[model samples]
Target chain A: MAKVAIVGSGFIGRAWAISFARAGHDVRMWDQSRAATGGARDYISGVLDDLASNDLLRGQTVDAVLDRITVVAELEEALAEAVHIQENTPENLDVKREVFSLIDALAGPQAVIASSTSALLPSKFTDHLEGRHRCLVVHPINPPYLIPAAEVVPAPWTSTETVERTSAFLVDAGHAPLVMQRELDGFIMNRLQGALLEEAFRLVADGYASVEDVDIGIRDGLALRWSFMGPFETIDLNAPGGVRDYVERYQTIYSNIFPQMLRRVDWAGEVMTTVEADRRKRLPKASLGDRQVWRDRRLMALAAHKKKSDREFGK
Target chain B: MAKVAIVGSGFIGRAWAISFARAGHDVRMWDQSRAATGGARDYISGVLDDLASNDLLRGQTVDAVLDRITVVAELEEALAEAVHIQENTPENLDVKREVFSLIDALAGPQAVIASSTSALLPSKFTDHLEGRHRCLVVHPINPPYLIPAAEVVPAPWTSTETVERTSAFLVDAGHAPLVMQRELDGFIMNRLQGALLEEAFRLVADGYASVEDVDIGIRDGLALRWSFMGPFETIDLNAPGGVRDYVERYQTIYSNIFPQMLRRVDWAGEVMTTVEADRRKRLPKASLGDRQVWRDRRLMALAAHKKKSDREFGK
Candidate 1:
């Protein structure tokens, strides 16, 4: 089992802690604020309980996994005896730089120092670190316990050995790690996401469809196949031949339409207001937490579906 | 039950005929070629048998449902008592225009004339038709029997009444129709698809990752949630507050990376060769048909999963 040190006991940090611990890792977490530490403890326990309730926790006992997680008050204590240090501090570059420097100083040379920065590139924080060779970005999708895909984004300066080792470590820990060859903002997930949002925003801004309808367009349409296969695989199966046939048939039209869709990102302020109003109409702010649970339940159901489908048909 | 006329007896046209037939529609299919009519008969029967095997055919008997579909040789005979005409001719503007003119002259005033054209704008085909008010693009995702998403793209001249009626008809026909307020090249599905492909191509072209890894990045990652909920709805449930909070947290980086990732599309020979090599290594051309069946079976399992999950959680 890997010994993981998760710094910053916030939502993401706590999530990472639970994910590792649930995967049978010896995890230690630390936070700057004592209050946040307590909250993290409560949150992690609650998350574990939820996992147990869903029968998703595979450990001998939830207590066994919970016992493996040690919440430390000191960052050095958390980093000590760890094979990998996952820094989940605030997204501020200065905070990241400071924390990364401390981690580099405290961690052993072989230890991988990974950051859970959703948007920030590793270079922004790891560039000045003395042990920068061991550092890379390991951005996880939200609710990492359920979603196991991690984007292992390495900076231009990050060593190849570090990237390879981190990828192997993550895979060993039951996470699917995708290595980014070059560091670009948003990584892979957010680039695809931004492209989608740009068009969704444009559609809403132009009064073509409501927020609800746009959501349906994805949940009920393209995203259904996308959930099982990526764009290339989707195209490959789309035509009789394969990707080449698909491209031959559709690429000309898609290429023709690409320019018009590439518009300025207007964020659709007015449309957002309308959407907010509609969202409020459908689901009140007071019930947002309940709705969030509904969303998680749905995600769990989706995850369960993927597991079942993959097993049955090798999807 | 809706009385629908399916024009043309190609693969897509046959699929549409089965869809309507399965939905308990009095479906009359018209084809100029006798060979095409015979092909449709065999295809429809095979699809019904498959549906029966899967326990998806809701009708009393597969034969009864098949009995409802009549193969008529003349357009006038097909549109004689039809309430809605679904034109599924080859994707050519001239052919569409010719069919639209013929259908408009023959069909009654109340009959909603819809084209299953994936790429053509309704305006190009319906501008000269007398029943242009009732004419619009009702483009379906392939194999609509399994994936029931139709983009109801209306031309600027298409009546709001027509759009609403078409939407209602599609919903009644057990299809999810997303109404596009105006015509855009590629419509909604393909545009979203194009955006994804652009990124996938760029990723492969730039040598950031392997084709298989890129496919895993989506299938195992973003598309998981996307299949059940859209990016906006996913983010809405992601953070504490919802989309606004999500944007505040991740937008800075997404905005930062958007420009850098927006590379020009290079559909050059070498890029295709590289992608093909990568894909062929994973999935050979000889086994494409077998893989397609695998894809369909997976889709079936996925559909079953969605049904169960949605029902259990009321999502």
Candidate 2:
């Protein structure tokens, strides 16, 4: 098992601890706050138990997996002998830069320092570091315990060895590692999501469809295929002649609708509020916590099903 | 049980027959080619059995469901005593217009003449019909027995009564129905899909990512939530304060990337070929037919899981 350090014991940090531990890596977790670090073990244990209840526990037993993670009070102790360090601090650039600076000094010479920032580019925080060549963004989906795809993005000066080694490390940890060609705003997942959300907001703002209708259109329609296949794969299987045939038949139509997609919607305006109001009507503020639990459970079930199906059918 | 006529017994029409029949509707099917209509019953039986194998069959037995569909040689006979006539002809406008004209004359006045055209607007085909008020587009995902979301788009002149009745008919047939706000090009499903495709193509073309990496990004990352929840609800629950909060944080980032999404990609160009080549590497051309079967089975399993999960946790 590899030695890994998870810096910042917040929700994502704790999740990274579980992911590494469950993959049989010895995970050392550290947080700036002593109270958060002290609570990390129990929090990780509770979440692991919840996953076990859903038949989503990664390893033999919760205790066996829990035994692999050590919650260290000091950042230096956490990074002392680590092969890789996963930094999950706040989204602010200043915080990330400070944390990475500390990690770069404390981490071993060969250790890969990976940031879990969803929005910020790796270069924003890692460019000035001594070990910047080994530093890259390894963005995971929220609650990485359920979703395993991690986007591995490298800065301009980041070495090819860093990308390859990090990719291998993620795969070894049972995560699907997707290495980006270069750093772009929001990366692939959010960019695709952003495109759809832009149109969705525009559709609502333009008074074309309700928020509920928009959700229904996806969950009930396109998502059925999308859950298993990507957009390219979906269109590939759409026509007899496959992707090219699909494009020839429908490119003009999509082009016509592309300009109609809203470039900018006032986030604080009626459009956002209308969608929020519609969402609240379905799920109120009081039940957000419960809905989150429900979402996690459903995610566990889906992951389990996907795992079984992939085994049955070659991925 | 409602009496439904499935005109043009192709893959979609036959699948519709099973959807309605399994839900206890008496289905009459017809195709212009007698040879096509002749083998439809057996073809449908095989698919129904496949769904049964996956524990996705709606009714008591395969034979019991199969007993409800009858393949008729004559179009007039098929349209006789029908409440809903689902037309699944070629995507060609002339073919649709000609077929709908025949169906409009032959079918009863109360029947909802719904076309299963994926990309065509309903007005293009049904505007001149005497029963145009009773006609609209009810586009189904292929193999509707497995994926039940049908895109219900109405022509400008179509009646509200037609929309309500058709929606009821679809739900009764155990399908989730999404009604479009108006007759837009490509409708809701394709428009959402097209937006994603545009971004995906541009990403690959611009060297932001490979074809495979883009697909992996969705199937592994976003599709997990999207399978059950739509984009709006996903972003709603993403942050504690809901969608407005998410937008307030990330709106500018998404807006920055929106213009980069390619407006048009030539179908016959290098981009399409490269994507197709990548897809072909993963799945060769010869294996496409078998892959289609595998896809259908996967859909069935997902449908079964979704049915049970939605029941356990209220949708």
Candidate 3:
């Protein structure tokens, strides 16, 4: 097992701790505020209980996996023997720059420093670091213990070895690493999700469909197949001759729709009123935390279902 | 039980027969080409066995569900006492228009004529029918028995009663109807799907990511959450508050990336080579038919899983 460090022991950092420690990595979590670091183990312990109940703790008891994660008080100790350091600092450029500079100075020469910043591109912060070649973004979907897909984005100066090693590390930890060639705005998942969200907003803003109708189109339709297979594989198996044949039949339709999709509705603009209204109508604003918990539970059940199916149905 | 007529006995028509019959509807299927209609019962019988094995026959023997569907030789026989006539002739406008015209004439005044055409708009085919007020589009994501989302799109001249009846009819068949306000190209599912696909193609074309990497982003990442929830509900439960809070925090990130996304990739042009090569590398041309059957089996397993989870999880 590798030695891993989670620099910011908030949500994402602690979540990473569970993932790494479950994968048999010794994880050290640290935060600037002692209060955040102090509560890290408790928060992780609570989630570990849920994971154990869901049988998602990799066949280990809650304490067995939880034992590998330690809440360290000092940054130097956290970075002492780290092989992969995942930075989850606040999403400000200046803060990330300062944090990376500090980590670069303190981290071992062989250690790889990865960021969990979804908002900033890697080049923006890693450009000033001496170990920039070994630095990249290993952005994960929240609660990485449950969701396995993490986008590994590299800067222009980031070395190929770093990308390869990070991908191998994630795969070893039971995560699917989307190794991107170069850093782009929004990376892969958000770029894809942004496209769908933009269209969803336009459909509602233009009065063609309600937010709920658009939501049903996914929550019931395409997502059912998408949950197990990618879009490429979905379309690949759609037509008789696979992807090319399916494209030959249906790609023109998307091409025709592309022109109509050239327009965009600002997510926070007028569409927010309708989107928020529909959401609040379904789920009151006060119950968001409970619903979030419910979503995580649903995710856990889905994760368990996938694991079982993968064994039964040859993933 | 309602009387339903499937005017084309192809893949979609037969799938709809399974859906309607399993819902205890009396389904009659007819096709213009006798050769096509000849195998309708046999094809459906084969699929019903798979459905039976998966326990998707609504707690009935395969023969009980199969008994509800009958293959008729004449169009008049299919449309005789039908309350909902689904025309799935072909995607060609002329074929749909001619077939719709014939069905509208033969259909009873109280019956609703619904086209399963994914390509043609309802107005384009239903405009000249005398009973156009009772006509609309009820496009099903193929194998409506397995996937429940169907878009109930109405022509401009279509009455509210038609849309409501279509949606209610679909709901009775256990469908989550995306009842749209009016006819639009691509409808709801395609509009949402098209947007994500455009970004997918753009990602590959721009050298930011490979086709497989883009697929991993969805198959392993967003789609896991999406299998149970929609984009709105996803973002709703993501932040501390709700959709508004998510928008307050993350909408700016998407808005910043929107300008860069004001671009398009030619699906049939250069990108086809990369996409097809990537897909063909994973799956050969000869295995597509087997894979399509595999996809249906996976869909069946997923359908069963969803049913069980919905019962246990209160969805």
Candidate 4:
């Protein structure tokens, strides 16, 4: 087990703590807010207990895993015995730079420093760090305890050793790591999400379908196949000649619609108003908290299902 | 049980036979090739046995379900008793026109004539039919026995009664029906798929990442959440204020990338060559058949997992 430091005690940081501790890592977590760090251990304990109840816990026991995580009040204390420091402060470059500088100075030179910045590129803050070569982005999907996808993005200056080590570590922790060969804005997930949202926005805005109906198209139709197989693998198995045959048959029509799909639809105008109204009807503001609980339960159930499935049918 | 006629004995038609028969429908199937219809019953029995073994069989027993299906040599005999005629001929407009005309003439006026045309709109062939009001598209994802999402598309001439009945029938058959408010090219599934494919193509074309890496990004990342909740519901549950808040935060960024995303990337050129080459290396042409079998098995396992999940979680 690696000695891992989690330098934030908020939602994502707490989640990382659970993931690392459950993976048997000796984890230390620190937040700028003393109260945040103080409460994080209890919060994570509850999460681990929930995961155990669902048969989704990764460790031997909840207490055994919780025993591995230490909630520290000071950043230096968190970094003292760490081989890896996961920086998960606010998504501000200024905050990130300051945090990395302190982490670089306090931690051992061999220690890997990673950030959980979803939007900002690592170069924006890590370029000036003495240990910049070890800094990269390990952006997790929200509620990483349930979803295991970690987008490991490397800055140009980040060493190949760092990328390989981070990916190896993530895989060891049972997280699926998608390491970027080159830096691109939004990485892959958000870019794909952006593309899908654009068309979903257009479909609703153009009055072709309701937002609810558009979503049904995905959850019921495309997502069932997509949940296990990727898009390319999907098309690869779609045709007799595999991916090449699929492209040959559908390329003309997709290209034809490319021009029309390019047309701008205002995401913030009538579309937002109309969709928001519909969403409000479906889920009232008063029920958001209850709905969030329901969503988490469903996610846990899905995670458990996928785990069993992967075991039965090799991942 | 409703009398259902499956008007083809190809892969999709045979699969539909299994779906309807297993759903306790008195199913009659016809194919232009007598040879095609002759071998269908044995093939269906094999599939039924597989479903039974997986605990995914819908009816009382394999023999009981198989007893409900009849492989008819003549189209008239098949349509004579069909309350619902599911046309699954070749995806040619000409073939669809001819089949629908025959089905319209032979079937009772109250009988619903639904085409399983994945690409062609219902209007393309149903416009000139005497019973055009009763004709619509019930486009299922391939091998609909496993994936139950059926796009219930209607031509302008199609009546509300037709849409409602088709959706009800699909629900009874254990398929999720996505009823469109109005018809559009490719409908929702293909449109969303096209949008996703376009972005995936561009990512490869631009060298942002490899095709394998892109596929990994999806199966590992976005697909996990998407399998259960859709994009809209996901965003809804994501923010504190729900969908509106999510739009407020991310709309500007998505809008900014709209133009860049709009740029057409040729799907048939060097990109396809590169992706197809990589895909072939991963699974050779000789192994494609075995891989497809593996994919089908995985799909079955996923379907079983989803069925239990939905019962527990309530989709």
Residues B1-315, model 3: lDDT tens digits: 889999988899999999999989999999988999888888888988988898888789988998999999899999998999988887899888898889988988879999898878899988898999999999999889899999998999999988899899899989999998988999999888888988888888888888889888897899988888888889888888778778889887788888877788777778889989988887788877777767777778888888887887767
Query: Candidate 1: where are CA atoms >4 Å away?
Result: A39-42, A49-55, A58-61, B39-42, B49-55, B58-64, B261-263
Question: Model 2, range B52-138, lDDT digits (tens) per residue?
Answer: 776777547899999999988788989988999999988899999999999999888768899999878899998899999999999
Candidate 3 lDDT by residue in tens digits, A160-260:
99999999999999999999988888889998999899999899999899988977888799998888888888888877777777888998788888878
What are the models' TM-scores?
0.94, 0.97, 0.98, 0.96
Candidate 2 residue spans exceeding 4 A from truth: none
Evaluated with lDDT, which candidate comes out highest?
A: 3
Q: What is candidate 1's lDDT per residue for A1-315, written digit by digit as tens?
A: 878999988878888888888878899999888888887776778877877766667645678889989988888888887988888888888999998888899887768999999878888888887888788899988778888778999888899998999888888776888888877777777777777777777677777777776777788788777778877788888888788877887789878867766564645356668666766777777888998788778877777667657777785
Candidate 1 TM-score for chain A: 0.95
Could you give the candidate ranking by DockQ, starting with the highest?
Answer: 3, 2, 4, 1
For candidate 3, the TM-score of chain A alone relative to the native chain A: 0.98
Q: Give the Å shift of residue A312 in candidate 4.
A: 1.7
In angstroms, give how far residue A76 of model 4 lies from its true place: 0.7
- TM-score, model 4, chain B versus true chain B: 0.97
lDDT of each: 0.81, 0.85, 0.88, 0.85
lDDT of 4 by residue, B32-87 (tens): 99988888999989988888888888637899999999988788888886789898
Candidate 1 chain B weakest lDDT stretch, 10 residues = B260-269
TM-score leaderboard ranking: 3, 2, 4, 1
How far off is residue A285 in model 4, in Å? 2.2
Per-residue error (Å), model 3, residue A186? 0.6
Which stretches in model 3 have alpha-carbon errors above 4 Å? none
